[model samples]
Target chain A: MKIWCDRANNQRVAWHCRSHPETAESNAYAEVFQLQRSFIGTSPVHVPTVADIQVVTRRPADERPAVILLELPNRHLGCQTYPYDDLVQISRLCRAANIRLHLDGARLWEIQPFYNRPFADLARLFDSVYVSLYKGLRGTVGCVLASSDAAFMAEAALWQRRLGGWMVTSYPVLIDCERAFNLNIGTFERKWRKMCAVAAAIVQATKDFTTSDGRPIVYFTPEVPTCCQVHTHIRGVTRERLAAARDEVERDLGLSVFPWTLPSPFMHELDPDWVLVNGDPLAVQGMDQYFEWSITDKNVDIPDAVFAQGWRAIVTVLFA
Target chain B: MKIWCDRANNQRVAWHCRSHPETAESNAYAEVFQLQRSFIGTSPVHVPTVADIQVVTRRPADERPAVILLELPNRHLGCQTYPYDDLVQISRLCRAANIRLHLDGARLWEIQPFYNRPFADLARLFDSVYVSLYKGLRGTVGCVLASSDAAFMAEAALWQRRLGGWMVTSYPVLIDCERAFNLNIGTFERKWRKMCAVAAAIVQATKDFTTSDGRPIVYFTPEVPTCCQVHTHIRGVTRERLAAARDEVERDLGLSVFPWTLPSPFMHELDPDWVLVNGDPLAVQGMDQYFEWSITDKNVDIPDAVFAQGWRAIVTVLFA
Candidate 1:
């Protein structure tokens, strides 16, 4: 029969669905734990929410799921960073239940600064670790899979070949990754701090978008974000105006304010009305519209004056 | 349960083993054809031989296998290319038997001339076609899976992601593929004619390496090669001496004559004794040593004079 390997990232996401009884025909044996949605931008799979991880893990051994997968910074539901203690608890529970735990650390590098731990330490919590080359690092294309089991890795190589993951030459990807690594070392940490402070300041300054009681007009999840990423729930605005604001920022200040509507394919598993605004609010509509914003290298260098001008344009478009 | 997709290539090769009645516990419902070994490289899976493709197809409909997979110009075997008539009968048989046929056209491009048909025509015979970007094209990583079934492609995408085949950015691989395509288009046809003519000339001139009966000291299959790929079995030379000849050709002539011994992972699925000598004789041991060579871009540009010198070195080391 013709067969192929499944993409590792998608595997991490879809594996969770195995536990849902509705999907039993395909994943009948799985004991799935539906965790509260964590951040995983627009990815079709819904990640378990961090709040539910402990409760799910506390299940009896026989009732425990066969595999537990976690994505650091949960880039989809909202850029939520779990505490080390919480991760430790989940890992311990998996161990007790004899379940395999895997990490989809596509943005692990982007979230590393908030954890205050080395990557190796975080990676040690799982049986296997997958790190992407191009996510936030802005490299070409590649991924690194790490595991303590040599046999598993050998099998992985066979699987990689089956999946057409074996490239005759990956020098170009390696070169680009190397270049990105050298240029980006220790940079995410700085960006993480700047993003949180700036997002909070932006929310505070936009008082007109808030309730009269001084409650903010916009709802920013993890209000102070865990890393460079932040999710925003826009209020007092229309989706078209938000989209217009995004265009205004780009046209007026040469900056992109990536805006998305609710129910994106990437976020279809989540609430459909949740719009994602990634790094700067451009344009969006509806009181329930959500978007995401994350500080990236491109905007990291924007002059303070230029950023302020862009912010003005965004606010003007939304309010005007 | 922890589940993963079987690596396609290896699965294609190895799945036949499941058809053996001894393996029926695992594949109780499968109507597997244990045909003779076809070219599957040294993949651990053993493919049915070309001789069995027809015999197996003529089986009762109830006994017909569910899937029939074929590789054009089988790379692991003697680079054999099936005639268009043979493929047509196989396709018609599969249709009659309600079996799904797929082609692993990894080297289909290399053997295009032997069939004298466009890729589309060859591909149309199967339910799906998988073409590698780097094989003879000498590009980077990536492959394209084509099919008339849109649903299958969509499903394949999910499997691709599960296997970590989804890359955030594959531009590096794409760019290299584009470059190779532009530079090498229509080049294979020209090289195919040159390789066959040169190989015949080389075999004719190396008469001294043969016995009085004219059966050469070395064996060449497709002695009239079906494509640019040729297999050789060299007797009468020490493996070390053959290796030295390879080094000398590369050092003195500034040309590489890539030589390899048996037991290479790439050839592991083949007989362990089948040593592959790509161009000229290089590293090999035993009078029964064997190797294979295929004309690729790396050696395609060698001047006729340089190649002649290299050829001389190869003969001298083996026969003198």
Candidate 2:
């Protein structure tokens, strides 16, 4: 993708991206190519608005971005995505402005249930689409990049050879990727439905819950997830405390609640003036522990009540 | 290796290499880095001499090479290696000249039998050593680069991350490599001995043989095997004819003689003034077909007489 980006914007023109600063696109542009990037702002729902994109496109000719990278269901921002009509408008705006639009469809499979649209319909809107086989598709590590532009893809192949990305044998990885895709692709819609039900149960069960410190204990970022993933925030709880509670619940009840948690990026965004200690704002305030709760076919079969009970057990240990 | 070369030779200092232009070092430096390279001439045995090393190191300060890359038992040149004494002198020469020496030990295992030296002892001569896990070890695919220079290895690791060389899970490859090394490392000396005996038998059986065109039918490049590999050149036979003969012999007698053949690089060197037709000299004179006959434990069990018989059948078919 870096190579393709380099080739697409050979003049080193600025790229427009709404993804987080930690994403592969942001890192590659800043660290590898040293290319300028213009970020589109997200609405309250955490999805980039058409107005936000026009703001960058309205800039002077010298400042106009050459390419706009859109991530389907932005993973870092609670896997939020624009409504289908809004996305279509954004795509049209880019085309009218002569800016190439690329899709970082790493989690494209997850959003299919929300849009209820065919993969081709979503992919056709972008000039280039990159999909990860390992993400929602449950494949081994690999990705496929599709582009209508033959020259761009040819340059990508040249770069692949130059960078030693072409392996002598990738048959094993490809075979595993195919097997995983076949096994899990059909289960995503069901998984997404289960995830929403599970989130609703947790929100209902912990409606008025509060920490020992008198702070709201738990809440969902979007209140309703668009995909099989949702970000759950635990106010007045340190990441360490959350992890301990999760481990305790799993050990005692044999129910795993969350794989891991970290200090939420939104905490700093919501409170820009928050004090920091030792380079960590979370050190001064404990109301920011968050984790992305992702439901796969493996756990979708478990009733939503079981998940609510597991979260309740975790919170009990947290406020103990 | 490309990244390490870029980091080490930051000023784009010229490199010294004796390996063929098709080898990784030559291609990376020429095509990737666009760095200047100085070639050290090989002796009749196709091993770079200490005199060749001095010629490059003796250059004026402005033209002195930064690094000298030496391939163990140059795979393209009949798997020939320098006498242990010559290699020691070349290593000392590079050190005295303040030039870093790197070993392209892709075939390092093949040369161990000829040098009769410990792997560590041979590796310690150069500033950095690279060995392929797949070539002779029969592993899947991977290589290890070792160096006492902490900074160089640290830089290599950084490049590995930047280039996406680090896999999500390489445990399977590592496990297979370890298994292959354990199974094959001890049998190299025996394989080398078997390869020499087989080569001698082939030479003896076909010494006076001639093609229908009155040209010599076959000959070994070095006239003796240095390691488990030897380059066998078939005079008066095009690569196409050689391949057909090999396939026919395999089908009829159930004996696989040569896996594949190509016009030997040495042929062009031997007859630089040969007339060319359609960009290939072999089209004008079919006297250059050759292939590297690499002996592994799989073939070492087959008697030398069987191999000699196989070659004889191939040649008879080629003449007919």
Which number leads on TM-score? 2
| lDDT by candidate, in order shown | 0.59, 0.72
Model 1, which residues run further than 4 Å from truth? A1-58, A96-100, A148-152, A211-215, A236-238, A248-256, A263-268, A271-287, A303-320, B1-51, B211-214, B236-238, B244-256, B263-287, B301-315
Q: Comparing chain B with the reference, what is the TM-score for each candidate?
A: 0.73, 0.86
Query: On residues A1-320, what C-alpha lDDT tens digit does candidate 2 reach at each position?
Result: 34444554532333223363334422545544455655566332355678878886677655667777788888877887878998899899888877778887888888887989899889889988888888777775777778888987886665555555554555566788899899988788888888889888998777668855565677776678888987988877777778888898999999988888777654344323323222436523655788876888678789999999988888777664
Candidate 2 ranges with C-alpha deviation above 4 Å: A1-38, A42-47, A59-63, A211-216, A266-287, B1-9, B13-38, B42-47, B60-62, B211-215, B266-286
DockQ of 2: 0.28
- Interface RMSD in Å per candidate, to 1 decimal? 9.9, 4.2
State the lDDT of candidate 1 residue by residue for B242-284, as single tens digits: 6777787778777665566442223223234433435222232
**Tens digit of lDDT per residue, candidate 2, span B187-224?**
88898889889989987777668855565678886678
